[model samples]
Target: MNETLPMTGKMNIAANDDWWRGAVIYQIYPRSFRDTNGDGIGDLRGIVKGLDYIADLGVDGIWISPFFTSPMKDFGYDVADYCGIDPSFGTFEDFDAIIAKAHDLGLKVIIDQVYSHTSDEHAWFHESRQDRTNPKADWYVWADPKPDGSPPSNWQSVFGGSAWQWDGPRRQYYLHNFLASQPDLNVHNREVQDALLDVARFWLDRGVDGFRLDALNFSMHDPQLRDNPPSGVPMERVTRPFDMQDKVYNQSHADIPAFLERIRATIDGYSGRFTVAEVGGPDPLAEMKAFTEDGKRLDSAYNFDFLYAPELTANRVRSSLSNWDGTPGEGWPSWAFSNHDAPRAITRWAQDGDVDRMARLSMLLLLSLRGNPIIYQGEELGLPQGHVAFEDLQDPEAIANWPHTLGRDGARTPMPWEANAPQAGFSNANRTWLKLDEAHKERAIDRQRSDPGSMVSYTRELLALRNSLPALVDGASRLLDTPEEIVAFVRTSDQGDVLCAFNLGEQAIDWAPPEEFASARMVADQDTVNGGNAIRDRIEARSGYWAK
Candidate 1:
């Protein structure tokens, strides 16, 4: 296990029953990744074209955002057809090609499964809405309006407004935790659960290595439709009525674990299938633990611990990682500093004029964590959030709450492939779904691919180091006592011990290296270390070091 894995060439991935444990997964937002067919939208073929790029990043797998048949209301989250491919993203042949290419490149492909909700255009929803007594009427969460014709309960949608939508034909209100066009599924129904499981089988049969369950906790809701109680503590940045409520009844239902068991069973029938749920709510940690507990559900789960954090601090890292301290039978955790739904880490965590250094430090921190690390598209390039004018906005949530919410559109911009090419080589079309950030050109893939000091190259080095070290991958991690401005942790395993330290602050700090780490050897570039005293004392601002 002391082999030094290079990031530039073909290599065999660990073919163990638990390859997902501590694996590095690269997340690809299809619409923003790379466009083919000159449609200004990334398609399955585009993913195939970039398979080499992803493989070169040294990640174990790739988690592609939804490309299923959808009306594009919530992008692909509001799936119109569970088993069909979206025409906008090319046909099924293109998908199969991408899967084959990824597998050939030794990269496992994990597609998003949005079973929590479906587009209003879905056939089942259409049939259910046609009449209350239809065969598919119970497929969605439907409730009768109150005597005064108001919503059945006080539940609110995550995107603002009421969670219940009025249907004229059925004369009833349907529950929708997200956009009105996206109706919550009736997972409580045995038939609906079976149907969704069948959908999983379809993809597994098609050779997808795993699934990234989108909002798994949001799949099941309280059958009572009770009004959510208000939070006692006032929210500091309330954007919608949804934020005011505790969100107890609308999400994180107790019945979710049972459904997860069924999903796990289905995936278990297939060889080497992995599942990771995206749990976001009032108590994401508790929900994530429950969803992945007992090894009978998902293999891993990630919460919004670092996704929406305003500042990156020592306490935040310690507190978040502490929740997943590897208890017996406890579920494994997956971590991400940036994703399609959140702002980029460079934009959110970097101090003024320190984006490049912060980017490298963040990669080292992510790879050194005691869980699977998911690198979002363009995160390797250290791309910042793109700026979009109010008039150019396409996201429903951002448009509904302008000037208040930072809007995920900024983070969902196109990936800059070629620094000088039109549209940054994302697509040949002049117009893209979201505006491309001007600053991204400087951090484009072509520009950084050859620069050894570039963020992309640094990411490759850090990932390679992580892959080479068994201690950093599957070892026990303990937070070390350090100043508030610095985060230090010791990872231990049978292989060896590794110490990772980072300065989150802007000013250099004097740090007395632990006796155990006095003779440690550096793993990558010690950009922030004071060469004057070795590891005896000193740390530069917005930099980190990994030593064994």
Candidate 2:
């Protein structure tokens, strides 16, 4: 299991050095992180400029959002060139420089790999649509129309309308689980999997430490094209329309892990490079388990367990974590409280002006849990959700569900780097893609970077503390007998024993640290709270804590 140090010689990863396990990963939404060019969009060069900020957070590595070449109809998810960087993001050379600099700074690099679909502009798809007999024709999921010229099935596009788009040249329709432009790849096709594997290998060869596979569960589809069953009284899946139904037919394909295994083998070939899948759908936890189970697939996977919850409560946290309670062989999990794709937890669970406490407690909870943690950009600074007007919105999902919900554009706003700088120091462009969210500026990273009481600083302290504690990183968790609204657990390792507690209620509750647990000391984070409510011992209203 000894890995050859690529820094010292021709490379290969060391399995035992599996750095991803319980590692703290920072997420960089490249487009909104920083803008090097005045072109009003963030690019790879912007990411390079922002690396110092990312490194200062004490992250083990970063998961840079997609920078792949694309038409950008769906941002970079509709990739036209898998192995190439988009002109909007920067050239491939820019990406290489970023990777080299990150490694030199002793940080691991994990970039996004969108294997589920491609832009219609992709040459392969263009050729496939030109005629039915083309070599790449079967590479995509093309279907004949049902009687009377309707779609082959009742599937709906994640963006808003029919999932099938007409291609005049071939006189057929192609399936897209998301936007019509971002067509799903036929992962069921062995050829398709091989091509995608090559894309991954290309990055591995380029020295990427790992990959964050986007929408992995959507890669394969049901050949039958059956209609999805309804969830009853159409509802939003967070902010996306695709959540209205059970999503049974469009995603969570049974054969996905079979393909994931191939992807696993590709990553395994490289040595230490890691991988984590972004799995979302009905039964995401089960799908996440299958994708990472028994070491046959990804290193770990993230779901909406914590992201979509209405409030950050001790019991809710307990219920979410308890669901994954399995033995050693079960698939490992990666936890995220906020990300570019979802609303910020502060906005999702805030009371009065206590959002700051919620931010810290959420991180403490995330850090104490038994999983790899992905701290979204600005979450460290305790950034609250921003407001984006309908005129400034870009997310299709947000636009479709406007007024009812604030839409995802509000959460996906630009990162605030400096409170005093114009536009919160994100860019100087006369007109950025989205307007600057007023509230986020005051909570910019630079303003709180040095403040010990700041959430950003708390994040650093907790991560540093966790790094020194073996139990926190590789421990087994067991629930302490506590009330349903209070989440308490113990994480044990060879280093020692550590116990955690959380108060997830609207009212306060007194809690006592267990005095009989061998030699237990209040290591750190003994009192966790949110919005005046104790999340740990006293169980502050809407708060939590971590103690040992």
Candidate 3:
């Protein structure tokens, strides 16, 4: 770790409360970002050391994944202590240093808040399972089993088994939407909600800027313990039984929005604080909107529309963007093509094709959209998915459904920083938590730091350009009529209108801009426009254009 980095006091940037709108947030999976100690795992000190690099990316903020005390059952997702930093990650002082360094660099810091469940090792869970009459007995979702000793409901765990785990002491079953070790909380209980709110106040009082609520829809469930219905589709080649069910009773309870309102009220006390929820399910759009509805809930919500997408198409982009039309009282949306849980977009979309071109085009499109765009760590470097063998896998979901799904381990590999340094400059230890991919070494930050054509450089340029244009920042967008392979949209604002177009196909075609944008000046492009004009008579394949 570089100990020389200064940890200055917080310095506020001149921005309004709505600064998060159209802002670019870069997500850092702390365990994979950089390792400071010889333990081969990244920590808070490592994040402090990398603040300058992150600030240089032109992103407005950084969202660090969960680093709270955990049992490592789900790689820090199963929180054992919501207020304490895990010793493996670092100390509370180390976390404060990160907040200081990030704010000093003009970057806001957002940490993950996992409130849906807690690790079975947590004191709350331990005490709740001891007896039914304890003070915290109803803290978690518990139900009596059927006379035949069956689970309370037919719900399935996201990690492959039943969502209920039997507690011998209580002589009843407990709900766990994810791994059995991660027992779901009874968020409907007022006492439980108050405790979670106290956890939020703990972080907010510590000078943290915001939170990315994890699995928020799973925070509340049906109190009746009703069974989930079939998905109404064939379950051919399903890896987990959870995919076969509609997940109605297990998650997305109607009362969740009221709890979200409580969360909003808590954060609203702290000025300039932001909150975005991570919602996923069969029908996530409605839940997402409910979670981020106008002034009562979260500030924004991001779904898995693009994160879990099998492929990227013009129609898919059009349909996804069309859902959030900026209507009155509608909630804002956040967009991400890659994250710690999903495979890199380049690997998923550019299979057997030119990855470099796809990376640039994807970056262009993400920044061109109306919603806030989140760039995952190493995404600016165009890092592809790393290959983790069966024996080396650490994800419980991946281990449970082995050989069938390319688990999230591939995308959680350490961030490569040097081309020739040991462990790709991620660590100096003999071995890291997850092996580094040799292919990533060539695309390391050291190699691309000075290369103008590198993905990192291109990403920085795009972010700067995006920041400079109000039409791209907080403008109203409208889709244009185009061919099947072409997607064109216009963003209108008080300053001006910016036209964005992209070719999702491999063949170049003769295309013309709408009559209004025919003479617009080209502000950014991937070799798609000619001589400052938005386009010539033709646009190249795998290219994008942004004009004002």
Which predicted model would earn the best lDDT? 3
* lDDT values for all models: 0.85, 0.77, 0.87
By TM-score, how accurate is candidate 1? 0.96
What is the C-alpha lDDT profile of model 1 across 1-548, one tens digit per residue?
11344532224245665778878899999999999888789888899899888888788899999999998999999999999999989998999998888877778889999989999999989998998788998999999989999999999999999999998988889999999999999999999999999999999999999999998888888898899998655666688888889989998889999999999999999987899999887568878888899899889999898898888888889888789888998999999999989978878887585777677777778888998999999888888778889998989888998988778999998999999999999999989888788878888899998887788777776777677678877788988889999888888988788888888887999997689888776665434221223454788877777777
Clashing pairs in 3: none
- Which residue ranges in model 3 land beyond 4 Å of their true spot? 1-14, 527-534
Residue-level lDDT of model 2, residues 1-548, one tens digit each, is: 11211121111112245767777889988888888787778788888888877766666788898888887777778889887888878888889889987886667899999888899899889888889898888988999999899999888777777889988999999999888888778888888888888988898999999999998888888999898887664443444545566788777888888888888888888877788989886468788888888998888888888777776766667776887676776888889988887888877887655787677767778888888889888788787888888888898777787877756777778888889887788888877777778888888888787676777766666666676666777678888877767788888888776777677677777876565553454555523222223223455655554445
Cα deviation of 320 in candidate 2 (Å)? 2.0
Q: Model 2 segments beyond 4 Å from truth? A: 1-16, 233-241, 526-537
Give the TM-scores of the predictions, in the order they appear: 0.96, 0.92, 0.96
| Candidate 1 lDDT trough over 10 residues, lowest sum | 525-534
lDDT of 3 at 350: 89
Please give, for residues 1-548, the per-residue lDDT of candidate 3 as tens digits.
12222212111122677778888899999999999997899999999888888887788899999999998889899999999899989999999999898877778889999989999999999999999999999999999999899999999998888999999999999999999999999999999999999999999999888999999989989998888998866767577888888888889889999999999999999999889999887579988877877768999999898898877889989998899999888988899999999888888898557778778888889988888899999889988888898988888878888888778999999999889999999999998999888889999998997887788877776776676678888889999988888999999998789999888877887888988877788888863322366356577777888987
CA RMSD for every model? 2.5, 4.7, 3.3
* Candidate 3 whole-model C-alpha lDDT, 0 to 1: 0.87
